[model samples]
Every structure is written in structure tokens, then in C-alpha cells.
Target chain A: MMDLTQPQWVKHVVFHPFEGFEDLRWKKGGTLKYTAVIIVALFFALIAFDRWCGFQFRPLPDAMFSVVPYIMKSVVYFFAWVLGNWAICTLLDGEGTMKNIAIYSSYALIPYIVEVYIQVFLSHILVRAEGVFFSTVYYVGIIWTVLLLFNAIKAVHQYSFTKTVVAIILTIAAMLVILFLAVLFLSLFQKVYVFFYSLYTEILYRLRV
Target chain B: MKNKSRRLLKQCAAAGLVCLLSFSAVSLPVSADEPYDVYNYNYLGEAVPSQAGYLAERSVSGLDLGTTALNAPSDLFKDKDDFFYLVDSGNNRILKIDSDFTQIVQEYKSFKMEDGSETTLKNPKGVFVSPDTGLMYIADNENARALIVNPDGTVFREITKPASTVYDQQLTFLPQKILCDNAGNVYIVLNNTTKGSAMFNADGEFIGYYGANSVAPTAEVIANHFWNAIASEDEKKYRSRSTPTAFDNFDIDTVKGFIYTSTSSGSTDTDIIKKVNPEGYNLFDYMSGYTWGDLFSTWYSGTSYKTKIVDVDIGDDGSINCLDSTTGRVFQYDKEADLLFIMGATGDQVGAFSQGNVTALETKGENCENIYVLDAGKGTVTVFGQTVFGEIVHEATALYNGGYYEEALGPWLEVLKRDGNYRRAYLGISSAYYNMGRYKESMEYAKKADASARYNRAFERYRSQWLREHLTQLLIGIVLIVIGIRLLKYVIRKQKNKKKHSEPAASGSGT
Candidate 1:
């Protein structure tokens, strides 16, 4: 008799991947506000993981200090995945709406956020030789997030395990196609802008003369 | 009036003569009286003008020895008796001068062959005197032969085009530089051959090519490999072949007998510098991804300029001094290939070269106290003597290389006093502090040096020590947290039970 819309239900969904997402799908357990907060928290966690982590674990160049890439990786990639999955699911006769799919995907990222915070804390205390322990926890968190994602997709779409896998693969392919189209469009616009700018410059030069 | 005009003309003539004499003296390019500044790079890899390193003592032009003004002196070799042999290639002669470079001991213009015929050199580029055999090996480049001369100026052996089946007959055997090992195995750097230096034995027989350059793994190479894998044999035959880069110059380390080669090509990055062992393998390839020369040219904007290493010289204390032709700078590294200092520049100053090619480098004295750089353009040899600061850095580097980290601490600190931007001093001091169990100070210095590995080691020790000192407190804190969590859970359950009972009663009464 627990309230399905409560923020605490995210913890339940993470621990009980098989039944928790199913209950969430049927009972409307996830809320948009809570999901948005979790996604934002994931973004901050990624920045902290990169910037404040131990030097041994941080592979990025120490000379550079930019967080825009981390933001694009977490926030932009998360939304892209949601949009890509939603676009794929429409063809597969998925029962979930785009809003529900986005909320579920964001809710599934809980384990990654928790693990990253723990890792950032542990990086200060652990040495290079003990990096294996940190890596294990880090990888386990990713695996847990992936499993929760699978469960969320399966429950929301009301699809079998194999069907969910196929849909996820199709979603990845669609994301690549979208990225290609985006790049093509940007380059085409750049060429058109250059052509117009040159025309305008020629006109300006003639007027000055 | 006529007598006064005649006296004015005589005075003008005298002044003109004095001006002409002074101009000729200044135009000579070899000035012994003018002091020259020597520079070394600091820790930040910036070329800072320092006080303790080499100063241009004197530039030996070999003009005083009554030679044709050392027309394009290509190579300089100091023999065991401290006699300097200048390979005056343009004059087709080798000038043997004394160590002080003031007196010519002997001049070898032509040598007597075994058949008693006099054979003169034609554009000989390199010369090396063997300490073990007391013989001279000269690279007769234009003649396409290497002459091994005896101490009495007789041609002991002549190494010409090899007739061996392994030696490609089509490839020209133009010897540019030559060196001999302690075992009398001759290594000749050919101008046209890319299969590495042609190796010869003591009997002047061509054994085979040794230490061939490895092709770089560029994008084109990878693409070619991919296409070749799927292409038919006919198509594969039409494909362009990948050729290895040829070495331009080389020098032999007398103690270890390791032949180090330098390629002056600006096009390729692979094998710009290499240390070849006796078995013809590049031992320096396992430097763990360390680049041999300057990673990026400071002069270029937005693009990186690769180093063109024209010559390499192993110093007396096993330091590798690589002469870069592109930047006209000498990058000196220790035995382990750690960059110690970057000296020389392309300018008209004392420590700089003027549009001239640095043909050769030689280190003299017990600890390589003096460095001689032969400039081909100016036809002069610049002698750089170590300054006090340079001496301290060298001493510290030697001690550090010899595994006397604790002993190197004093000199390393003294080096820091002279040059605060000296990265090597910071590294040396950190290592010394690390060995002395001063982990905190070691970490600080390591951070300053940007030596992350050393800093991590020190941090590990510091962290463990801190953990050990606070272990009891940490355990007590953990126990208190566990108890507090359990009590909180117990209180929450009791409150929930009470609420459940009251809610059920209230619901029953409402019904």
C-alpha cells in the first residue's frame, strides 16, 4: 500500500529491478519532478567524478579544466537516449508514453550517481595499487544501471526480454543516424551562410567604392 | 695651400686602411676575445638564460693553423691524446690540431695505399679515431668509400660497395658518417640506403644492414594494411610500397658500444633518434612512449614542428646530446633518456648559431666539462664550458642516475637556489626526500615537478600513516554510527506501530 508516486519508490525500483519497474508502470510510481532531479544530480555527479577524483583514477589531461564535455556526456546523452528509445518504441508497439519512458530511464540512473559519489570520496583515501577495488565498484554500478534500464524498458513497453534487447539495439542505431543527419545539416547551413555573407560583402565593397 | 691639401689626403688614406683592417677582423666570424652567453632550459621547458652553464670560451676556425680557413669543417673528433681532428671536407683534408686548438699537430691530405699509391680524400664528411687500435676511420663520402687509415697515415683497409648478396647492388653506397665499435665492427651511415647503416666486420667484409628504421604507424599505413588484406595479388603488386627512413648520422658509445643514430628528416616522427645495441636492435624503443625530441616547436603557431635531429653524441657520463637542425637547438638527455637541458638557438648571439648547420658535437674533459659544437656555415667550432649552476645540475643528475638519491639532495637544493623553474631539480629533490622518508615534503616537490607517479607514491605513504594514526578513532566512530542507525530504526518502527493501531481504531469508529 505504499505511495507509488513518492520519491522513495526510486530506491525500491533500483533494488527490485524485476518487480519494482512493473509496479511503477502499472501504478504510476515515478514522478517527473523526482526524475528530473535525479538526472540533474547525475550531471553534477559526473562533473565531481571527473574534477575531484584521485589523480590516479582521473585519466583526463590535468592541464585542461573544462566541464562542458562532462555536461554534454551526461545531460545531452541521457536525453538523446530517451528520445532515441521513444522513437524506436513507437514502431515496436510499446505501451509506454514518451514522458513515462524518459522518467523511467532517468530513474534507472540512480545507481550510477550513488556509485560516482562514493568513488569520488574513495579516490582521496585509496592509492594507485588499490585502484582495482574502486574500478570494481565503478563497473558494478554501471552494470546495475544497465540492468535497471533493461527492466524499465521491458516493463514500460510490456515486451519480452529478447524484444526489449532488439528495441535497445535499434534505438542505438537510430541515435547514430540522427547524429549523422545533425552534422550534415550543420555543415550545409554553414556553406549557405558563407555564400550569403560573401554576397553581402561584395555589395558593401561596391557601395563604399 | 697645396701642402695642406696633400697632408689631408694622407690622413684620409691612413683612416681608410684602419677601417678596412678592422672590418676584415670582424668579418672572420671567429672571435676569441668577445665573451658569449650559454643558456639551458628550466623545469617549465622554457629556454632561460642561466649563469652556471656553458659560456662560449673560443670558436676555433682552424685559420691560425694556416689551413684554407677550414672550408666547411664537417666533423670534429678528439683523440685519446687530446688531439682534435677537424674534417675539413671542402678542402678534402683532415686537420689534426692540439687539444687547446691553437696548434696543428698533423694534417692528413692523402694516405698511402697498400700498393704504395697516394689516394687523396674527396669531400670526406665524418672521422673517428679508434682508441683500442689507434687507427682513423674516415667517411670518404663523395668517393663512396670508407678509409680505415693506420696511425702512420697508411690506408689499412678500404670499404667500398659491398658485393654481398644481401647488399642491394642497385643502392648506392655513399658513406656520409662512420664509426667503429670496440669489436672492430664498422657501421657506416649511407646517404641513399634506408635499410639502416651498412655493417662491416674487421676484415672490411660487408656483413649485412643493421638497425633498420621501423615504419611509423600512420593513418595511411593502417589504411594500406586494411586494403592489402582484402585486395587481390595483382592489385597488391600495384600498391605503393612503404620504405623505412634512412639514418642521417650516428655515433658509437665507447664504453657500452651502443651505436646511436639520428635521422634529420622533418617528414616522419618515428625513429628520429635511436640507440642500437650490438645485436642490431633499437634498445631505446622501450622508452614507454617517451618522444625523443621537442614535442612541439615554440616558434610555430597552431601547428607542431617536428625535430630534425641531425646528429647525436653520447656524453662522457652517458648523456645523449641530440642536435636538432630544424630549431638549431641541442637537447641533452641523461642515460635513461630524461631530458636534462635544451641548449643552443638559431640567432647571432654567443649561445646561438647563425643560419649555419650544426654538423657535429663533441664533449671533452673527464665529466664532459666542455661541449664543442661545429658549425658548418660559419666554418667554426664553438666551445661551451660548464658554469657553476650547470655543474651543480650535472652533479645532481649524475648522483640521481647512479641511484644515490639521498646524496644528490644537497646539489639538487643548490640547483633550485639558482633556477627555481628547474623541473629536474624539483624531481631530484622529491626523489631524495622520498628516499629519506619525508613523504609530505616529497609530495609537495613532486606536485611542483608535475611528477604524478612520485606524488602518488608519497600520497599513498602519507594516507596510510594518517589512517594508522587515527584507526582507533575511526573504528569508534563507525561503531557509534551503527548504534545510532539501529536506535533510530527501532524508534521509527515503534512510532509506526502506534500510528497503525490508532489509524485502524479511528477507521473502525468512522465506519
Candidate 2:
């Protein structure tokens, strides 16, 4: 049998969510490098979905490309959820480590990445009238990803279903708090920089006098 | 660093001078070489160089006709006899000029009432001549009344504020423009009424308001509704109330008797142009998805400036000419509301308006050969006569709009010969070919025009034709492929059985 502790075991875990994640936890199969690669791939897939989708599905034909928001949405959001869940898990006496949570969460995103690439390819072939078919596939992919995520969290943390639900809600709340602080930090930095720059300008004026 | 800064300043000055020179060059009046610069958007919505449908023939000021200078002429009306009526609002008089605009036929400053008393107009803003009765109707704006007078200057009727309980008594009755139908039912555009124009009977009796503008549902309106649902009565009292926009000007379609109204405000996007039926419902409401005016402002970035339609004129051929005061351009639409042409601009040149509002627009001649635009600021009426290129386009458009697709094909092709970038010509030619049962050619033209809907229709027909032509060959090929696949499978199965038997026998012998 193929070794369950290999990095390639993530594929088996994603396909067989109930059994595969339980085996991954027992075998210590998940790896941080694989998860980081998956996150980067998902980001590229998202950019491709936006730029190369059919005109019928592309809402903003004249939309400009901005990479900063994409990075925030994919990479920063992934880390936020992992860290948030890790903090909540510690209080709840969950068994998962931070690395385990990151690997499991990234593995759960496999379905979404595959779905987006498929959508990008199908968009070129299908017209507006056949949009229902494309949307059904898209929605199924998202639901499958969500189910995988639930199973991953449950198996990695070794928590009951109810505890997993509460843990997810707390993690979402933590994400919001983290986002608020990030915005606050940016604004405070701006104000401080402005204040110091004005002081420098005033000192230069006095020296010139 | 100091030398570099000085160089930068010199470069900036040079650039500014170049900009000023280019602007002045554009502002210079039309010379013989460059008669007029005209353009129109093609099918792809890209502006392309095209012929000016109309050339500025001459500007007729009241002074040129030996009459008092037209002071802020707010309106112009063309009677059935082709006589021009200028509402000299600032002068408080109506100057009637002949079709040639050279001679003043008559000037009516006051009318004789039934009591033999003289009732003079005060800042009259609008004048209309009834084709049915051959009488004149003047909107006495300052006096807040409309006077119906005979051709001989005798007051037939004077309509003042309606005394009905339905009429809001608090609102002032300032009539700015007036028009009459063949049935003699009068419509008066009031200055301050958001409820729409006030209608009156032939005998000067008050009727209810007609065709009020509807408010556009913006985000603020939705938010206000949400707040109002939960707000206390005392809190609601302090909240601002939403009101509909008012119609600025209107004209009657003599043939269909439909009233066309234009609102000139830039703030509201809803009901900028409306065609009102006699039942007081806007016929243009059916066109909910279409936008009237410039899709995007050419001057402003990331902001859409709605067309401020100040005046609308319906031609004999069922074309609607909307005069946009903001851009000082006339957007002409056919009966189906397809834009046919856009002319004029805001500038100091002869073909443009100089800080002057395009107060009124009128079309003359059997085919609407002449277009007259009155500039209130310049106190001049600039006449535009159709060019040869314009004539061809109008001829083609008239035929196409009239549902003569086959007949319009020749003229549309002729238009393409003159200007290959004309998108309308491509669409027209494609439609003509489609109706002529030439789907392939139609698809080519539709593709050129970037009209996907038309291209899809043509493609459907073309695909069916191709299928029909190759149906027999396709059926034969399918049958042959199926037979070949079955034979190959049988042969492969036989070969596999033989190989299995041979392998088993060889293994037994080896053992």
C-alpha cells in the first residue's frame, strides 16, 4: 500500500474526507511546504478566473488588475483563519497544532482551486444561455470544499461536531477583530508619519531662517 | 537641482502655450477650407470621422429681420404654413417671421379681450399656432396665464389658475410653455409643478395634471425607506421628503397626438425624456433598460454626466430631435429611439454655441431637410441644411426605420462606400441581407458591427443551412464508422482469445 505519511497523501485526504483526514492525523502526513504551494496556486487560479472567463460571465470587462487585494484575499485570509482557529483551539483544549490546522485548511481549498480552473475553461465554450449548468458545477464545488473543511477541522482538532461548529464561529469573529486591528495600525502609522514629517519641515524652516 | 527646476518651469510654460494655441485654433470660425468638423459613433461606440449632416447655413437674429433684437428668446414654433414664431420672452412679445426668416409677418404684443379691454402679455415665454383652428396660443409666464387668440389678435380664451379642489391652491401658476392637440385640449408646462404639466379643455376649463416624472430609486432612497420603517413619528417629521423631478419643456406629436417631454436637470437620471400618451402614462417607460444621452461624459473621469435635454422636436418623418443644453448638441433619434445623428458642440465657432443655451430646435421641409437651433445667449437662430452625405444617411435611416429593410440596402451600401467606419450602415446592410435570405453575408456584416444578437440569429440560420446541405454525407459517415468499430472489436476479441490460449498452453508446457 502507498505510504499514508507521504506529502502526496493530501490528495487521498481531500478525496476521502472522513477516513483520509483521520489517517493523515494518525500518520503525521500533512506538510507546511505543500500547503504554502497550494495557497499560491489557488491565488493564480483566482486571477485566471477573473481575467480569462467568458465575456458573458465577466461582469466588469473594463476592470483593471490589482494584485494587492488578491494577495490579501488569498494568502492573508488563509493565515488569518489558521491563526484565529489556533488561538480558539487552545482555549477549547483541541489537539491540533498550528501547522496541522494550516495544512488541513489548505488541503480543503483543493476543490475550489480545481473548480475555478474548470470554470475558466468552460466559460470559453459556453454562452450566456448555458450559464445554469456552469453555475451548478461551481456551486457543487464550493459546497464540497466547505464539507471537506468541516471534516478537516473536526479530524485535526479531534473535537466533536458541536465543538467544531463553535470553534468555526469563534475563528470567524477572530478574523474580523484581526482585520479591524490591521486597518487601525495602518491609520496610526500614517498619522505618526505625517506628524513627524511636518515636524522635520518646521525644523528645516527654522534652520534656514 | 535649481537649474533642473528652472528647466521644468520653462517646459511647463511651453506646454501651456501649445494648449492655448490649439484651443484658439479650434475656436476660430469655420473657414472655406475647413467648413465644419462633424463626427458620429459607429456600431462599436467609437467616434469616427464622418460628414456633417448639416452645415451652418446662416444665423438669423431678430435685428436681421428689421425687428427688435430677440432678447432671450425662450421658444421657437413652426406653424403648418411654415411660419416661424419666436417667443421673445425678455421683450414680452411674439415675433412671427415667415419661413424664409427674412420678413416679420406680424408681431402680437397684446390682445383685445371680449370686454374690449387690452390684455397685454408679461414676459411671454411660449407661442404655438393651432393647425386645426389657425389660432395662436401664448404662455404669458409672468401673468400666470395662457391666452388663446384669433389670427386677428382677438382673445378667444384666457386660462388662469384652476379653482378646482384637485389643483393645489398653494402652488403658483406660472405657465412657461404651451401646446395644443388636434382636439384643442391644451397642455401647459408650469414652472414650479413637479406633478407634471397642467392640462385644460378647449373651452379653458381646468383638467388634472398629466405625465408626472418618476423618481429614480438611488441608494439614498432605499436607505430612507429603511429608516422610515423604524423611525418614530417625531423623528420622521424632521426627515427630508423625496419628490419627483419636473418636466422642463414639451412638444406634441401632431400625427399620433403623443406629448414628448424633456427634463433639463442634470441631477436626476430618471425620466429625462418621456413620451406621454393621452392616458397620462409614459410610453417611454417600456424602454427601462436604455439610457438616453451620453453613456459617459467625455470631459469628466469616472463620472457619467446625464444629458440635460432642454428641448425636443418631433419631425414630420417621426424623428425625435433632443437638444442637450449641457453639451450644446442635438441628438436625433428615429421613431424606434435609435440614435441617428448627433450635431453641434459648446464652443465659440459658427457651428457651435458660445455659452448660449440651445433654447429650441425645429425641423423644416418635407423630409425635414433643414434644422434650426435657437441660441438664447447669442440671440441667434443658426440654420443647418442637409449635406449630401447627410441626405443619404437620412434616406437610408428613414427607409430602415419605416421597416423597408430591403429597400434601404442600396442606400446603406452607398453610405458604406463614403464612410467605411459607419456602424449603422453595417447593421442596416446586415439586416437587409438577413431579410434577403443571405445569412452568411449577414453574419459577416453583423460581426463587423459587433452586434452579437444579430450575429447569433444569422449564425443559427447559416448553421441549419450547412447541416441541411451535408445531412446525407453525415449520415453515411456515421453508419460507416459504426460498422468499422464493430468489425474491429470482433477481430480484437478473437485475437485476444487466441493469445490467452497460447499463453496458457506455453505456461503448462514450461511447468
**What DockQ do the predictions score, one after another?**
0.24, 0.09
Chain B TM-score of every predicted model: 0.82, 0.87
Please report how far candidate 1 places residue B285 from its true position, in Å: 1.8
Task: Highest DockQ: give the candidate number.
Answer: 1
RMSD of each: 12.5, 8.4
Clashing pairs in 2: none
Model 1: per-residue lDDT, tens digit, B133-220? 9999999999989999999999999999998899888888788888898989898988887888888999999998888888898989
lDDT of 2 by residue, A67-147 (tens): 988798889899899999999998999999999999999999999888999999887556556778789879988998999
Question: What is the per-residue lDDT of model 2 for residues B222-325, given as tens digits with 9 covering 90 to 100?
Answer: 88888988999999999876788899899888888889999987778878889998787888888744456666665668755556889999988888888888
Predict model 2's lDDT versus the native. Answer: 0.84
Tens digits of per-residue lDDT for model 1 on A54-91?
76566434567777788677877877788889999998
Clashing pairs in 1: A4-A29, B43-B421, B43-B423, B52-B387, B52-B389, B53-B387
The CAPRI class of candidate 1 is acceptable
